[model samples]
Target chain A: MTTPTSRPDPRPAVTMSVGRDKHSHYSYRDFFRFNREQGTIIDWNNTQNLLLSEDFIVGLQTGLEREVGDASAAVMYTIGIDWGKRDAAHFSQWYEREYGVGVKQSNLLFLLETWWWPFTAQGWGKWEVETESKQKGFLFINLFDSMVARTLGDVGKPVCHLYAGLFAGFFTTMTSKELSCIEIQCYAMGETYCKFLLGGQERIDAANFWISEGASAREIARRLHQE
Target chain B: MNSMFAELLQNAEGRYLHPDELESLRAYVEGIPKRVRIYQVLHSKESVLLDRVMEKFQPTLPHLTRRHGILAWERCRRDLGMVWRYCCMAMLLNDEDYLRDKLLYWLETILKSFKMRDECRPAYKLMLDSLASIFTAEESEIIRPYLLLAKTMLVG
Candidate 1:
């Protein structure tokens, strides 16, 4: 497995003051107070509560670490010759040694760009079946569609809008590599915004669009460039 | 899980209800002379005990007819201030329509009561939070917007 020369600290090292944005809708103190008051809603069995209170925090910490380790493994598996298997143990050890402090699942986000590469390979795109199925199978399609309209600009192609919302929803639920299949499908559908936003105009297949789907990939690329 | 439950039971160190108490509850369930006083006493002193019993009994509750369950749930919802028990009852009944209507009704009552008595603001907030947690996403879509508006007014 290929190893990085150095690992950056995963936690934010520099302390920054919280500042209210000009359009700040809620105050931080009020949010905390709301959460505190909300705590009374659950009738905690006192003894179980006390035991679990500490355990929950520690479990969260460990879960995060495992998630990051998994993400990094995906990255190494993407780049290394044998898909990062032969040196898996050593790579994991190195990651733990280098980034042991406050390393958690949220840190998996740091390895996304690296892990996302192998997902682009031809046969690796089927993993997104669940996300696609969730979108197509659900009856409340408009709820998500409207959310996309509000978040992304309303460019108004139904398929493109659906894909955008699907991307955001999958981002909430899946890992980066798992989401890559949806990204590939969007490319197949000739979604220009999807290509620009997700594929970064690099490493996108220019010939795959017309291979089976409605529009040619080159045709979509040409249209985007023209615009 | 049983060990955990047993440990909680030991630690709470609450009073164990006599055989008479179970008989009284059974009588109440069986539609004998209404014993509001006995229930009130049980609720006031043994609320935790009631909660444990409700948790243990929930799985078996689904087999009961909807009419019977709803009647029992209505009494529990009205007489006992146990939000979790009410939620569990609604879930066990497994009728989404009934669950939504009853939960919303209870929430509206709590909200109205809070409005009538300003001192109940904290309790009202807790009730709303509990309602939000218990209700399904579809149910929440109906209740949440109004609840949020009320919360905003209260916070302000």
Candidate 2:
């Protein structure tokens, strides 16, 4: 009989290391800092901080309602679209600096997430973006824990118009094509998460009409799918 | 690595320093023990420190979120985490030029894009409070100057 012999394990054991060799994972922390003495917030590159309060955000919404009435949503949406354009420009520069590659050269999902990281850090909720229909000039976004609607409770109607406008604006800038968005579902409507559909003006208009006729989100999705 | 560091620093000044000058500065900061100690403590306590800081901000998060939106508050939380990490690395390098470069580069971009200066105060105070609660007197003494330096640069 052949004698059996034990062999040393060939696989390397996994161990965490704290050493100079490992590159520190870059995070939002790498980008900014705050000073208490001067009551200022500055980025790591030493620029002044621009900040706002929750009161300002809500007040913007309410103040618009008082001034422009029903036209407020359109104004907010228009503002978001413009903001998105500026953000795209800023993001292009920032991304190039941080990663040594232009934003245009990055992978789509990576680019979107990187673009949204600041908003997330700035106190928007976490989100998931669906670009499955990007080639068709449309996309879907689901936002969990939406700040705008989180405290608004179940008012039974979509209450995240600002986010909808933001998506519409940001995407329009990113794609260099006019896109609009509508919140088909919202946390204020007693949903677990808010859902938004963004596409060209024609598609959004159809969705809006269907929505006015009381179409369910699923029905709207199916209808938009056919379009 | 040396070239990259020099390039980043030069980018900050908008002009390149002489190669010899960059090398001298790099060599000077190479392995100071106090710097290493600060890095070790910061890295070791990072998660614990973050949790404490978050707890300190807990009561205010709802108010902040209600006003700014969840997206903004989320960003604020994340930025606080990053601030701690940056402070640690900045302290370890002990290179003022490097710190200034990183500060100017990041701040310029953030400030240009978003109006978020007001959010910094609470976060800074909470971070200092968290650090005080955790660090021993000797440890705090060693790390305090570096922390303050980072805070000043950030504010400046």
Candidate 3:
């Protein structure tokens, strides 16, 4: 009826004007369902959830440390990796169902924000993801109020190995690449928040060496940028 | 509209909201008429608004166009489009912190990282001023604070 006045649309049109619910795509209220009468907690993806106490979460680490000694970090990390990989499948499923977009097709940063919101909603923490360096084969995640680190507090070393493992495992499964994550800085180490470096195995190896040599997150970032 | 009503009922803990929390619900309802109008206007007239912004922008910041080439207009339009969308979303949600936490923080980092800050800061102000032509004072009041909120976060 009329000449097309604009260039080809760069993105999906804003469909909110056409009777979409303000929260149709999602909302915190709808993301999780709690049935007090039935004593059940179910998420949008129909996954069952457990409510954990801070005492239990802290005791979890102490108990692990008591049982396995210094290897507790590795044990926690292994659990995180497995947990993350499992979540990836669940993430991909609901992600497709909710948005009608495949994981790979959407912009990674946007997809990542969507992915992390559930974690944030579940009280894991709020996080900022840096992808400006993604083209250089790696990225950084800054996590505030890490459930593990916040509860453990000021132990003077990277105490978020589970977080690092979770990141590594999630990305590895999502990308189908052998990616790994290293805790470059942590709140428990007297930093304000935790910082993680996610990349391929080679990069993770280099970071492992650097950490052993006492390099800071900033130092590790600089070296990675140089490479 | 249903979401707001649903929100009036459902909460994270499977419990009803306190009467005090409904204060925000009430505000969201009051702003709905203006928010819906602004959202429709922004959606339908996106290109026109972008062109109007460019009309002022190209003449004022001639150096950026030359430095960046013709593609800069595309990038500028996309940036302004994104900014306004965030503004509209924040207005609709009636959550004052939505724009800052969701978009401006990310936008600021990208602009600064690419050395686009000095040039882009003025555009944000221009973006706000360009809306004066269409939005009435009543509509402007609904939108202005958010645009300024964005400007406060990014321009400064």
- Judging by DockQ against the true structure, name the best candidate: 3
All candidates: TM-score: 0.21, 0.52, 0.65
| DockQ for every prediction shown | 0.03, 0.02, 0.15
What TM-score does chain B alone reach in each candidate, compared with the true chain B? 0.25, 0.65, 0.79
Best by TM-score: 3
Candidate 2, residues A1-227: lDDT per residue as tens digits?
01111322111221222322212212344433455655655442233445766676678777988999988878876776666666676677766776788777766776776677566555578788877777777888989888778755677888788788778777777777878899888888888999999988888888889989989888988876786
Report i-RMS for every model: 19.2, 7.8, 7.1
Model 3 misplaced stretches (Cα beyond 4 Å): A1-27, A132-137, B1-127, B131-139, B150-156
Model 3 chain A: weakest 10-residue lDDT segment is: A1-10
RMSD of each: 22.1, 19.8, 9.4
Candidate 1 vs candidate 2: which has greater TM-score? 2
Cα lDDT of model 1 by residue, B1-85, tens digit: 1223334457557777557655754544553222333323323433544444345444544543463345764443343343333
Cα lDDT of candidate 3 equals 0.76
lDDT tens digits, residue span B37-60, model 2: 767877898878778877777676
> Which residue pairs show collisions in model 1?
A64-A104, A64-A105
State residue A182's C-alpha deviation in candidate 2, in Å: 1.7
Tell me the lDDT of candidate 2.
0.66
Decide which is better by DockQ, 1 or 3: 3
